[model samples]
Target chain A: MRTVEAMLVAEVVARLCEEANFVLEENIHSAFQRGFEEEISPYGKEVFAQLLSNAAIAAKNRLPICQDTGIVVVFIDLGQDVQVTGGSLYGAITEGVRDAYQRGYLRKSVVNDPIERTNTKDNTPPVIHCRIVDGDRIKISLMPKSAGSENMSTAKMVNPSKGWEVIKEFVVDTVERAGPNPCPPLVVGVGIGGTLEKAALISKEALFRPVGHRHPEEIKAHMEDELLDAVNKLGIGPMGRGGRITVLDVHIETYPTHMASMAVAVNLLCCAARYKTAEI
Target chain B: MVIKRVNTPLTDEVVQTLAAGDHVALSGKIYTVSDAAHKKLVQYLGYGRKLPVDLSNQVIYYAVATPTPPGRILGSAGPTTAERMDDYTPALLGQGVKGVIAKGYRKAEVLQAMRHHRAVYFGATCGIATLLSMYIKKVRLAAYPQLGAEAIYEYTAVDLPLVVNNDIHGGDLQREGRIAYAITQGN
Candidate 1:
């Protein structure tokens, strides 16, 4: 059995939080570049140019790309064969998130309660999802989800008879309703054929995939392409200013569901598309 | 389609000439307020109580900036969604707030208030906080210190960039821009 120090996990989480906030991932950067080139509207092109420069400025200055530094969503794939030492895994991870937000000067946007709405002061208790795998290696992925795009995410349980066409329509309609609100050009993640909650989880997990990477399944990959084309055709553009490149990518993940119900969830990520992964 | 460089404490005359789709680079002093601060401001106004800061002819930026790091005037400062603050916007406009810098659409009531008050709504590109922070030279807490990041901050900005989405004459860039580029896909 391998022993992974909780301190090490904390250190990695801290670095991931800071790095993810400071740097725009290369895949997202390249996607933005492509969107910049393909954008037909002069205004859209200008918006993309500004976004590119923003990424550079954030990196050079070691600053957050956006003020809403976002609620940290950490996905952990822990090896069953590995045991955590020094501290509880959950405590260490939360500590890392707290230190990152404070030390890195990222915004503490999380509140203690949804209704009372008191600031948590230090961003803590990150939404952590952990899965135990067979191997002796652990993988940690962090996605900082900003409210602008997150507030626009939706999930629905559709009648199974509504089929794929309706699911496609729902995704497009969600983007359309989002308009400039979700900060298009967007990265859209669609989760289909799961339980209601599972659909939401997978839809969010879908965002961690590198932009433009396709699902292994040919049919799912084709649907991603079709959704990408359809969303772009909406002409919401960069910053929703109007152009041909409204969506940078569309990702879909699916699971088996009960025959009577089809659950779909759409997770919209803004152009920043900030995330990072580390494995040990 | 013209780009205009404007100074803050935006005047009625300047706002009148502006139209949707006009790009603006705004300099001078502006105040930052988000949902919490807006709620307070509107509540004070509703009760006919004195506001902590004067609003006449001031530009209000809808932002909740991150904490300033060492030796920095401000941290990442970008627009939050304007729609969330729609309920309180009309009251602020009624108090002579001249313009707002934010992203996303405004409700009809907010637009109507802009038309009535001759204020403009400027759309700052979302998720570009670090870039926008460069324009902010100074920042100070104006009110609601308990609110932390959501506190009202008075910011001195230099050529902060934005696009006019809604102008005094009922021009709506968001609506117009989407309509211009929207393609009809067959069923």
Candidate 2:
């Protein structure tokens, strides 16, 4: 069995947090470039240009791409053969988030309570999801989710008989309702065929997929393409100023579900599309 | 398509002349507030308490920026969603708040208040906080220090780019833009 120190986990999480905030991933950068070229509205084009420059400024200066440095969402794939030493795994991850937000000059957006809201100050207790995997290596990914887009996410369970057409319509409707609030050109993640909560969780996980990549299954890939086309046709455009390219990409993930249920969830990631991954 | 230059403490005449879809480069002093601060302001107004800062004729930007890094006047600062502030905005407009800078569409009540008060709503491009911060020359926390980033701060902004989304003349850019570009079902 391999032993990984809890402090090392903290260090990795801290570094990932800072890096994700400061840099716009390559896929998202390329998507922005495409949006700038394809956008028909002059106003939309101008917004895209500003977004491109914003990404550059954030990267060069090591500043956050957006002031909402976001609530930390960490996904961990832990090796079954590895053991964590020195401290509890959960505590180490939280420590990492605290250190990164404070030391990196990132914003602390966490509230102590949903109601009677108070700042958590350190940005601690990240929403962490973990899975046990086969290998001896641990993979950690950080997705800094901003509330603007996160607030736009939605989930609904449909009758299994309603099928893919209804699912597509639901996805499109969610984007239409979101309009400019989530900040287009958005990365839409759809999770299908699972329990209610699982669908929501997988929808968020699907956002980590590289932009423009499709589901491996032929039918699901087609659905993603169709959904993308319909969403852009809504003309929400970049910043919802109206133009071509409201959505950069649509990703869908699925799991087995009860025969009576057809659960679907949509998670919208804004143009910032901030996420990063590291393995050790 | 015209880009107009505007200054703070927007006058009724200036706001009345502005129309939706006009690009603007706003300069001069502006106030910043977000969700928590808005709630507090409404509560203060309800209790008939004097506010910490004067709102008459002042422009407010909906922002809760990151902590300022060393040697910087401000951190990545950009517009937040305006919809969340809808409930408190009408009351603030009644207090003579002349203009608001934020992103996204507002509720009918907010538009009504703006039309009634002859105020205007401008939308800064969302997700471009770092770029937007370049225009802010200075920032001073003006009230509610306990709210942290949600504190009401006075900011001096220069050439801050924004688009007029709602104007006093009853024009709405969001609806117009969508109608102009949305593909018809048959097509």
Candidate 3:
């Protein structure tokens, strides 16, 4: 068994926290540029240009692109072959997040209560998902989910009879209803099958895929393409200014479900898709 | 409803000329508040208490931000979803609030309030934190010190960009944009 030191996890998480907040990933950048070139709406084109400019300024100046930095969500893949030596894995990751927010001048968004909400000062105790895998390396993915988009995510458990048409309609309807709210030209992650919770998890996990990448399964990938075409046709445009490109991409992931259940989850990631990954 | 647009760094003349459906990119003094502060302000106004800052012709950004480290003025201080403040919006607009900066759709009552008050609602691009931060020149706390990010802080912004989602004249850009873009073929 390979022993991964807790400090290594902390260090990686720390670096990831800062990088995710400070930089818009290159994939998203390139995707926006593509959107800019394809956008017919003069307003949409201008908005894309400004978005590119916004990213550039943020990267060069080490500033966050948006004011809502968001809640920290970390997914860890620990190979069964790997054991964390020294300190708890979760503790280290949380500490890393806490330190990164403080050191990188990122905002601490975690609050104490859902009712009498109050900021917790340090962005601590991130919503972490740990999975045991087959390899020896430890993989960590950080996604800072902004409230604007996260608030709009939806999930439905349909009867198996509801089938593909229902799924597509629901997904399309969700995006249509979302309109400019989730920030148009959105990256939509659809998780089909699985249990109710697993569907939501995979939907979010699917968002970590690069902006233009497609799922490996041919059928699933085709559905993604079809969904993309439909959503873009909605013309929510860039920033919902009314353009041809309402959705930049649609990613779908699925798992076999119980015969009676067909769980559908739609997770929306806005243009500010802030995430970073590291392996140790 | 009459719809329009206003570019940022607005002058008072531009603000006054703004009719319904006129979308504006606003600059200058925009205050930040969220659910907690909104409740406080409403209560204070009920008692005829003077606000920390005069809200006349001012814009309020519906947001709850993370705390920044030492030396930095603020941290990812982007607008939160505006619909959450629907309950308090009409009251604030009644009290001379000229505009709102946020993300997402507002309730029907909020839209009505915007029409009645001749106020506008603008949506900053969602998740664009770094981009939005550059426009904020300074931050000054005004109320609800205990709320941390939910505190009412005044922000001086320069060319703080936004798109008209719901204009004063009752044009809903988000609604129109969706219908305009709906897929028909094999949709």
Candidate 4:
């Protein structure tokens, strides 16, 4: 069995926290250029320019790309043959997040309770999804979900009987209704099939995929392309100023489901698209 | 395509002159609110109590800024989703607030209130936080200090960028742009 030290995991998490917030994913960074080039609306063009510069300034100065540093969500893939030494895996992750937020000057957004709403002061106890997989390494993928776009994410139990058209309408409608609220141009992640919660999980997982990268599954990938075309045709544009490129990309993930259950979820990521993965 | 320079506290003439699709470089005093503090302000009026900070003729930006880090006057700052404040909006506008800065659309009632109050709604692009921080010169707690970020804070901004969204004559930038672009596909 391979042993991974708890302290090392903490350090990686802290680094990932800072890097994800400070440096946007490269695909998202490039999408801004494409957004600038393709945007037809004069106002849309201006938004693209600002978004491009916003990233440059954030990266150069080690400043957060967006002020809403966001609620941190992580997915941990633990190899079945690996053992975490020195501290609990959960403890290490929480410590890493707490240190990163304070040291990096990112906002602490987690509230202690849903109703009482007291600030945790430290962005700790991140939403973590753990999986046991083959291999001797531990992998961590992180996405700091901004409230604006996160608030706009939606899920519905769709009917496969009605087919792609039904799923297409729901996803497109969600983006249309979100309009300029969550900050467009958007990266839309769609999960079809699986149970309700599973659908939700994979949809967010789909976001970590690089922008403009097609799905490996040919059928699902085609759906992604069609959805992207339909959403762009909405002309919500960059910053919703109305243009041809409202959505930067649409990513879809599918899973086999129970006979009657066909759950669909759409997770929206703003242009910043801060995602980082680390292996230990 | 014309960009205007707007200073505050805004007068009726300034508010009336603005329209959708116009860009603006806004400077001067502004107040910021998170949803929590906004609820308190609206509740104060609901109970017929006086607010600690008067919003009359003043613009209120719907946002919560990050805490200042080393070597910065203020942390990265930008607009939050505006719809969360929709419940508190008409009350603020009715109380004579003239300008609102945020990203996204306001609800139907909020839109009506904008027209009735002759107020202006403006949007700053989302995710441009660090860039926008360059324009904020100063910040201080204005009221409800106990609420932390939920407390109202006053800001001094110079040439902060914004686009007019909803204007007094009933011009709406997002709606107009959305309709124009989507309709082109016969969609």
TM-score of each: 0.98, 0.98, 0.91, 0.98
Give the per-residue lDDT of model 3 (tens digit) for A61-103: 7877776677899999989988899999998998899888888
Q: DockQ for every model, please.
A: 0.83, 0.81, 0.56, 0.78
Name the DockQ score for candidate 2: 0.81
Question: Could you give candidate 1's per-residue lDDT for residues B1-187 as a string of tens digits?
Answer: 5669999889988998899899898999999988999999999988999999899999999999988999898999999899999988888988899999999878888899888998999999988899999998888889999877888999998888889998889888888777788787662
Residue A163 in model 3: lDDT: 88
Q: What share of the true interface contacts does each candidate keep?
A: 0.76, 0.69, 0.66, 0.77
Please estimate how well model 2 matches the true structure, expressed as its whole-model Cα lDDT.
Answer: 0.92
Which residue pairs in candidate 1 have backbone atoms (N, alpha carbon, C) closer than 3 angstroms, thus clashing?
Answer: none
Winner of 3 and 4 under lDDT: 4
Candidate 4 segments exceeding 4 Å error: B183-187
Candidate 1, after superposition: displacement of residue B78 in Å?
0.2
lDDT of 2 at A199: 97
In model 4, the Cα lDDT at residue A170 comes to 97
Runs off by more than 4 Å, candidate 1: none
Q: A-chain TM-score per prediction?
A: 0.99, 0.98, 0.97, 0.98
Q: Predicted candidate 3: what Cα RMSD to the true structure? A: 3.0
Better of 3 and 4 by DockQ: 4
lDDT of each: 0.91, 0.92, 0.79, 0.90
How far out, in Å, is residue B5 in model 4? 0.6
Runs in model 3 lying further than 4 Å from the true structure: B1-16, B19-25, B65-76, B185-187
lDDT of 2 by residue, A59-122 (tens): 9999999988899999999999998999988899999999999999999998888987677899
